[model samples]
Target: MVYLDNAATTPVHPTVVQVIQDALINDFGNPSSTYRIGKSVKHALIQARKQLAELLNVSETDVYFTSGATEANNWAIIAQANKSREFGEGHHIVTTAIEHPSVTNVTKYLETQGFDVTYIQPNEEGEITVQQFLEATTDKTIGWIAMAVNNEVGSILPVQELGEAAYEQKLWFHVDTVQALGHLELDYQALKCTSFVGSAHKFNGPKGIGFLVYRTYQEHNHLEPLLHGGGQEGKMRSGTENVPYILGMVKALELAKKDITSNFEKFEELQAYLLTSLDSIGISYEINGDQKNRVPYINNLWFNGNIASQMLIKMDLDGVYISAGSACSAGSLTESEILKAYYPNQSERWSQSLRISFGYQTTKADIDQFIHTLEKITKGKIDLWHSNK
Candidate 1:
């Protein structure tokens, strides 16, 4: 089947699988143990952290491994509120309306506990401007969290601008870089954000492992540990470190970094082909995000009158896999909250949206097959509509 759901997750790379297997066979020791096996595993975790830090352009001490981006996102934002409650700097947060549920829900949870949150609306282009962010900031705002690239629509946020704005206001900045990692070049030092989170699986690595990178350890705020027991990840995150998965994740990033330029070029070519084919089919589609400014791998389209759920099922049946929206909220009957926030008056248009994402393994042949199947499906539906007319 043609899997176009990279925004959800990706199949682990063969090299990554091999590395994971090696770690399981050779590095089976608990990282917290005082014995040699433990020491060895600890070293492995340390080395993985260092490699990830190097990729993010941050210090090794600032990189903390976690279960996934969801956990990292929760830990970062909630921790900001918790710290503020203790130290009394602020009780407010500013985040875009398009945040992944990981950030959106956590912010909502904080709001229930008396912390105020301002959800900034993005423009029609599915992009949050620097000015909108600056306008939303208040003295009570303790932190601002947003995604580098939107998980559903693929719009790239002005992270550097947001970081600069946050810096000027002395507010903590956290970015959910889950969709942007490996898809874009991210330098935590360059962006100057307080923290950024990335999940490995999005870049052809194994699931259940990710990392959070802080810009600096000095003056850094701590989270109330989500999992307690072993004091792993410097007590920021606690538990036995998943060395095999971590190693695989590191190798996946290594591969992505080495071949990113070529991969991006290939995706752009595929995107152009797909768009051309869509145009040729005479299918009515609205590009959801800023097409010129999005990541090369993602394309969110609103098929004017078609039901996204029906199209997804039909695509799956035709051996072409696409998605209705973010995989995190896929299969839910409700409309996309992100779309609703941006196009509040257009429920029909919003329900018709679908997100097609590419990955390292996507190819021209795959796009051709998908476009052909789509054309046939849409043509049959159009014929039926005219008959009814």
Candidate 2:
């Protein structure tokens, strides 16, 4: 099967799998125990955190492990909102409409809890400018929430500039780096965000393991514990650590960091190959995000007509697994909120775009198979279909 949906999740790397397996078999002791086995396990956890921190260019003390990106996003946004609302800090938030549901849902909940939120819409190219955010910022705005890279269209947000804005205004800024973790080079120090999150599965690591990195930019900057139990993660997040998964995640991160540059160059080649193949087939299509400010891993394509759902089925049947949008909402195959925000008036664009993402394993042969299958499915009606503006 040609799996071009790496933006949803990546296949676990062999090295990471071996690490997790070894941990489960030989390092099974709980980190909390005082025995020698436990002491060694505990040291491993600390080292995992340190290694992950080094990869993201952050301090080890700032990282806290969690279930995944969803939980990390919730903990960061909800905790900050609660702090601002309860402690009289501020009751307003600034975020983008194209953010992952984990963020949008939290902002929606905050609205019901009496905190005002501004959802910034992306421009036609699926890019949000720093000026738009700065203009929306008000004195009552306490925090800013956004993603480093959009999962749907791969649009790279102005996170650095937004971070600078947040820093100058002394506002709490939390970035969801879920899609950016391995694909983009993140200078955590320069980001100036109060916190940012990463999910292991997106980077060829084991699922069910991710981390959150928060900093005390202000004296009151603190996140209340989301879970109550053995008081893990410095008491900010509670639950027994998944040592094997942690090992797998850190190993995956190490591999990604080592190969990021080479992978990027490879992706550039793949993108060119894809575009040329499409043109050779005379298939009418357009990229769905800001061409200049996007990642090469995920490419959202707008085909000629409202045929994404049908194309998804045809591709799946042809053994080329792609999706119309985020896998989280694929059960319903709903319109992409990311595209909606970018082209609010153009329903055709939002409902018809296919998300074709590449991973470390994706190859030129896979692309050839995808294009061939796509050509067969789109045969005869190619003239009837016209790519929307």
Candidate 3:
């Protein structure tokens, strides 16, 4: 099958799989234990942290692993909110309308706790400008959270500028880089944020493992721990670490960094090919966001006279897999909130959207087959697929 849903998750690399298998079979000792085997396991964990730190251009102590980006995001936002309360700052937060549910839901939950959240709406391009964020900020605004790249439309935001603004205002800045980790050239120090969250599954690493990078600028911890136990992860996160998954994530990240340039060029070519082919097929379509600013790996397209859910089901049956929106909101028949925010008046466009993401494993042949299948399916030829189903 041609899997075009890399935005959701990627297939783990064979090398990473092998490393995880080896660790599980040979190094089963707990890193928190004081025995020799445990010490060795602890060393493995340190090495993995160091490797990832180097990849992100940060110190090893700044990286803290978690169950996934969701937990990391929750910890960062909630902890910062708590810190704001302790400092007597009013309950106000700044975020964007196009953020993933990880950030959106947490902010919603904060509202229930009496915090005021300003969701800065994006322009038609699915991007929030720095001015928009500045306008949203108030004296009570204690934190700013946004995503580096939008998970649904792949729109790259002005996160660096926003982070700088937050720093100038002394408001805690947090970025969800789950979609940008493997696809973009990331310099954690350069991002200038209080912290950033990422998931390994988005980069061909194992699931159930991700990290939060906390900038080490001050002596005191600005954020509190969500999980408390043995005081692990510099006393910011607690739990016996998943050593095998950590090792596997490091391996996968190394591979992604090693081949990022080549993979980027490949995806660019594939994107151009797919769009051109779609035009050649004489299909009516409209791109959801600003094509010039989006990452080449993800394409959010709107086909005329087609429903996203119906098209997704047909595409899956035809061996070309894609998604309607974020996997977190998959199977929901309503329009995408991101699209609605982008086009507040044009509500019908949201139902026609499909998110097709590319990966390192995607090839020209795969795109060609996908385009052909999509054309046939969109041409009102559904009897065969329905009969087979």
Candidate 4:
């Protein structure tokens, strides 16, 4: 099968799998225990934290493990909001319209709790500029949450610039880097965000394991804990850590860091080849998102007058796997919020969109097969629509 839905989740690397399996069998002791077996597990956890810290160029203490990006995001946003309340700061939050549901939904929930939220909309290119975020900010704005790269369209936002601006304003800045962790160059010092979230599954690691990079400071002392039990994760997140998955995630991160440059080059070549092949087929389509600034792995296309669900179903039948939008909202027949944010007035294009993403396992042969299959499916759909018209 030609799998092009890597943005949703990637196949775990063999090395990562082996690491997890070995840990599960040999290091079953709890990191919180005081025994020798537990000491070994604790060592593994520390090493994992060190490796992830090195990968993102951050201190080991800053990396806090969580169930996934969703929890990390919720923790960051809600904790900041709580801190604002405790410190008598503003109750307003600044975020973008194109944020993943994790951020958007949490911010919406905050609104019900007497907090104000400003969702800055993106331009036609599916990009929220630094200026847009700056303009949205106010004295009442307590924090800002924006994604480093859009999950559906791969649009790279001005995260570093926006984070710097947030720092200047003394507002907490949180970035969801789930899509950017493995695909983009991550410099924790340069981004300057108060915190960032990432998932292991997005980067060829085990699922249900992710990390939050929280920059600790005296001002953030009032941040509330989400899960309170064992007082783990620097007392910010409380739970018995999943040592095996953490080890697996660290191995996957190491591999991704080691081969990021080569993988990026390969994805770039594949993206170019796929676009050229689509052009050769004379297909009527428009590329969604900012083509110039987007990541090489993800390509969102709008095929004229085509229903994304139908295309996705047909492609699945033909052994070509792709997605209509975020995997979290895949089965929904309605227009995607990401596309709607880009073209608010032009609603017709929303249903016509599909997201094709690449990964380390993707190949030129896979692209060629995908293009051929897509050309056939799109042509047939166009013919059927025209005949009905």
Model 2 vs. true fold: TM: 0.96
lDDT per residue, candidate 4, 1-389, as tens digits?
89999998999999999999999999999999999999999998988898889888888877899999999999888887888767787888889898998988999999999999998887765568888877887778888889999998889988888888888888889999999888788687788788899999999999999988888544554556777888998787888999999999988988998999999999999999988888888877788887668998999998878788888777776778898788875456677898888888878778889899999999989988788777777667423232211
Candidate 3 per-residue C-alpha lDDT over 277-348 given as tens digits, one digit per residue, 9 for 90 to 100: 989989888888756678999899888678888888788777888888888865566689988888788777
> Superposing every Cα of model 4 onto the true structure, what RMSD results?
3.1
- The CA lDDT at 218 in model 1 is 28
In candidate 1 the C-alpha lDDT for residue 234 amounts to: 79
Off by over 4 Å in 2: 380-389
For model 4, give the 10-residue run with minimal summed lDDT: 380-389
| TM-score ranking, best first | 3, 2, 4, 1
Model 3's TM-score against the true structure: 0.96
Model 1: per-residue Cα lDDT over 1-389, one tens digit each: 78888998999999999999999999999988999988999888888888888877778987888888988888777777788666888798888898999999999998899998889887766568878877887877788887899988888988988898888888888999888888787666878688889898999999999987765422647656668887887786777889999999999998998888888888888888888888987877888866567877888889887787777767776778888777785457568887887788888867899888999899888888788767766766423222211
lDDT of 2 by residue, 1-389 (tens): 78999998999999999999999999999999999999999999998888888888889998999999889998888887788777787799999998998889889988998989999998655678888888999878899888999999889998999999888988899999988877778788788999899899999999999988888786776778889888899887777899999999999989998998899889889988998999998989999878889988888999967478878777776778988888876488887888888878878997788988999998999999899878877773333243211
Whichever of 1 and 4 has more TM-score, that candidate is 4
RMSD of each: 3.2, 3.6, 1.7, 3.1
What global local distance difference test value does model 4 have? 0.86
